[model samples]
Target: MAIYELRTYNVIVGKMSEVVSHYKNEGWPALAKHPQKLVGYFTGDVGAINELIHVWKFDDDADRRAFWAGVYGDAEFMAFAAKIRPLIAQQQNKLMLSAPWGPQP
Candidate 1:
């Protein structure tokens, strides 16, 4: 089964656009190049108050780990993360797999 990672960041009001753009240009491309990650998307909602949601699809847990290990250790990724740290209040994430269907080929 394919897995998806969902992360929510509580971004400071004025920084949402900036943070989103940064992710669009840097993080998104970096993740897409990973061997396991298939795609990623971001969403913003007023209901959550300056919230940013990101969804990432991966082949499996091992693949997810490998991709993250590389991204986390890279100097450029580290710098980008640092740049957004102050603009965020807190973040939470969950890893989920697509639900299987009852009758389908």
Candidate 2:
């Protein structure tokens, strides 16, 4: 089964653009290099003040675990995260296994 790593970040009003831009400009490059990351980005939406959602696909649970362990321990990633910390209000995560009932192929 294909697993999806979902992160939803709530950012301060009027700062979502900044949050988005920061991820694109600085964060994405480093994340793109990660072997387990299939896709990552932020998208605007309702029900939240502002949203930064990232979806990462992995081959298996071990792959995902290794990737996150390294990501959380990386100095550069930590720095990048710090840069955006003050701009965000909260963050949530969901780890899901894809289902056939989801959107059509």
Candidate 3:
């Protein structure tokens, strides 16, 4: 079964657009080279402001670790991360497993 990761980025006030733009233009494309699967990307519409949420799926913990290790060492992704670091106020992630009876993606 695939393991899912829910990643949320809390951006500095009024800097959400910049972060989204950078991800749309550079980050996502670069990450696509890896084996992980992107489920979706979303921005806050209500509740919290300046927040971005994205989901990814991997075969397992080892797959997730290997993919991220590559991303961390990738010069292009590293540069992209540097550019967006100042825009992010906080970040959070959770790993999830699907229930057997639940809807599958």
Candidate 4:
């Protein structure tokens, strides 16, 4: 069965702008070179402020591992990551499997 990974990063209160700009200019561009596993990226509007959330789909756990391995091996991505990391206050990740009756991402 396929799997999905949900990543949530809580940005430092005033660093959202910095994080956003960096992701726009550097992070996304670096990540674009890898296999396109991303489903989408989102930011909170009302209740969940200062959070950056992204979803990704993979064929299996091994595929997910390989995908991240490729991403981590990229120098540009790692550089972007170094810039972004300090701005993130906390992060949460979850792996999920689709329910049988639902429309899938």
Which has the greatest TM-score? 4
The C-alpha RMSD in Å for every predicted model, in order, reads 3.0, 2.4, 1.2, 0.5
True-structure lDDT of candidate 2? 0.78
* Number of backbone collisions per candidate: 0, 0, 0, 0
Q: Which structure is stronger by TM-score: 1 or 3?
A: 3
lDDT of 2 by residue, 1-105 (tens): 667889888888899778778887877766666674757565775565477787888777998999988888877778788899999888898888877796721
Q: What is the lDDT of candidate 3?
A: 0.89
Task: Evaluate model 4: give its TM-score.
Answer: 0.98
The clash number for model 1 is: 0
Which parts of model 1 are misplaced by more than 4 Å? 24-26, 29-33, 36-38, 102-105
Q: What is candidate 4's CA lDDT for residue 22? A: 97
lDDT of 3 by residue, 19-97 (tens): 9899989898888777657898899888977889989888989988888899889888888899999999999999999
Where in model 4 is the C-alpha error above 4 Å? none
For candidate 2, the per-residue lDDT at 65 reads 91
The TM-score, computed over Cα atoms with residue i paired to residue i, of candidate 2 is 0.80
Q: For candidate 4, write residues 1-105 as lDDT tens digits.
A: 999999999999999999999999999999999999999999987988999999999999999999999999999999999999999999999999999996988
Candidate 2, poorest ten consecutive residues by summed lDDT? 40-49
Q: lDDT of each structure?
A: 0.75, 0.78, 0.89, 0.96
User: Model 3 clash tally?
Assistant: 0
